[model samples]
Target: MKHLTLLVPDGQSKLSSIICTYKVFLKANAFWKNIHGSDRFSIQLAGISDEVEFYDGLFSVKPHVNISKIAKTDLIIMSALNNHDYPGSISRNKPITDWIVKQYKDGAAVATMCTGAFLLASSGLLDGKSCSTHWAAEGTFREMFPKVNLQTNLLITDENGIYTNGGAFSFLNLILYLVEKYYDRETAILCAKMFQIEMDRNSQSPFIMFTGQKQHGDEMVLQAQSYIENNLQEKIVMEQLADTFAIGRRNFDRRFIKATGNTPVEYVQRVRIEAAKKAFEATRKTINEVMYDVGYSDVKAFRDVFRKITGMSPIAYRDKYNKESAVA
Candidate 1:
């Protein structure tokens, strides 16, 4: 079993940080447990200070595990500190950066979550390395760390020994990647299943397309959204929807844009594709079964739509998820 050391912050919101850190720990533990029973991995918490209190009325800090031992651990994860109070600067603490750099030089894999990337960038550890953070913090991260390559599209980036994930819920992607690496793809799938979370495994993949944002001139748009949701498994034509909504085709198009931010066809496709994603992740159904359930009649058409929406074939999606489950 590999040892993971989590470096938690001290002060207000520390309780929230601890909660997030524990989630990460539980995810990793569950992932490996699915693979190798109960005795798989271990996590040790090394608090920066004795204990910290949160304004929201929460307190957290695991019992003392010496700071030096943390450095020796195989992996180190830096959780996000208080983003609101920290401002645009990388971090208020310079020694934290130095310690991280030293750990990297010593051959331990270092990682950070959300704005924790700021700490890594400030340490110069991510210099010239492609990294990402939550989209909300893109501008701040870019301006503060010019040397590091900022990649905002990915949920997580694994650069050799360094890994960084966007804040919020992107930590799942990081944990999934770790599961896949140490165990296998099946393990990752099992982890995702346990959490009831689903995401396209590929960063370049497009799991959804919104076509309706063209031009809105009516109430027909929201009606279109409702219609698509109701008829996801049926072949939907634009004229049919317009006639059913009791409006002219051109007029329906204009109203759909106004109500749903997408055109009728766009809305329909989005609904079908979204349903397909759910079916792919939740069921062991075959590709053809999924394709038909999502309303595509021809296997070829289903493949095309699946590829267009997810950047992967339907079979690939099923296989990938299954592989992750097995690995987990």
Candidate 2:
């Protein structure tokens, strides 16, 4: 049997992630027993404390085993941390982080649910590995773990036995993925039907809300970003815009990338696409009408960029998100 350890992390962790993950693994084991006449997962909640409480003790979890007592584990699932307090959680969970590092080196595969990526990333096993987390947490995550590759567009990332998924509720998708990988596709599909979770969801791009990368303290880059966002329908000439800002085009491109993590061209494209996404979500505009309003004149060019960024064609995105448009 595969011994699965669900971590009940300390310091304002999401109670639902721990509860939901525990339930799924237990159900998976039940499904396994029905199919193979034996249990597949030896699941347990392991944490530093005997009981971890959340929301002023409205909810609490009592682990089956403490971290220090477990010597061998086949898998580890970290519950998501509270978005507003992950740094504090990481600092307070120092012992847990250290234990995770030791456990991973001892051959236990680790998976993180949503913002749980922060704790796993803190363990240093993800220092040079690719990771995924909630798209809204991208700014803070990038600032905290610059060495780890943060792929916010992907719904799931699997590298070197480390698995991560994007944002809330999306953790269910990762659980399904792990089930298929270690257990079997038959069990995964069974669980999917039991839970009513859509399967094979591989991208979180359409859900991203880009407000422009403005976390740095570069004043000139800030001004440039504001310009790009304000004039989303314009055909921006980067070199000319650089000249207007009283900097050489090359120096401007260098500084823009350094501050915003995107080149001037990519930044402008994102701003335009962001506007297009909003239109699709909230308005009843046609695909070509919205495309032109966002500054793209070529039908093929606009469709290609839309699909590239959102992982869906314009009509598909609109149909999925806009109720009025879907009916139309």
Candidate 3:
């Protein structure tokens, strides 16, 4: 039987993440017994805390074993930390993080859910590997772990037994993924059916809200972003924008990218796409109309950019999101 440890971190963790994952794996174990007449997994909750409270004391979790007591595990799953103070969260959970590192070094696989990637990245294991996290935390994750490749569009990133999933509550897909890996395809499908979760969902792109990265405090770059947002329909010439700011074109591009995490060109595309997404969600605009409204006149160019960023074509995005469009 594969030994699984669901980590209960020392700090604020999404209580649902730990509870739901535990329940699913337990169901998987029972399903395996029905198929093979034997248990395929052994699951336990391990933590440093005797009991952890959550959501202002609405719930509490007591792990099956203290992390220090469990010397070996076949798999270790870290729950998402809801706290924002990354440095402080990591420092307080040093023992837990160190334990995770030790387990991985001793031939165990590690997986993190949502912002749980923070703890995993801090362990230096994801130093050169790719990871996925909540889209809203993209700036913070990038700034902290420049060595770790953060892919926000992908729902999951699996490399060398280190797994990560994107955003809140999407961790269900990761659990389903793990079930398929450790148990069997049939059992995974059954769990998917039981939980009513859409299976084989590889992209989290459609759910991402592209609020422009604005944390970097560059006044000129901030003004440039506002200009782009205000004039989404206008032809935004990068060089002309720089001239309007009275700064050199080259210097303008440099500051814009450094502050907003996108070049002047890419920023325009994202803002336009974001506007297009909102239009598709809230308005019944036809694909071509929405395209023109977002400043893309050419049909092919708009479709390509929409798919490149959102993982779906214009009509597909509209049909999936807009009730009126779909009904029509």
Q: Per-residue CA lDDT of candidate 2, range 92-211, in tens?
A: 888988988888888989999999999888888888888999989988888889899899999999998899999998999999999999899998998899989899999999888888
How far off is model 3, as Cα RMSD? Answer: 1.3
lDDT of 1 by residue, 1-328 (tens): 7777777655433344456556745776776676578734577776555554455545456535645556466777777756455543344455556776787788788878777787778788899998877656665666678788876656678896999876566666676676677666776677667666564443433422233332333455656766778877877888887888788999888766545445667667667776787777777777778778878888887788667667678777776766554454
At residue 324, give the lDDT of candidate 1.
52
lDDT winner, 2 or 3: 3
Error of 2 at 109 (Å): 0.3
Total residue pair clashes for candidate 3: 0
- What lDDT would each prediction earn against the true structure? 0.67, 0.89, 0.91
Best by lDDT: 3
TM-score of 1: 0.56
Number of residue pairs clashing in candidate 2, backbone atoms closer than 3 angstroms, sequence gap of 3 or more or interchain: 0
Write down the worst ten-residue block by lDDT for model 1.
207-216
Instruction: In angstroms, give how far residue 290 of model 1 lies from its true place.
Output: 30
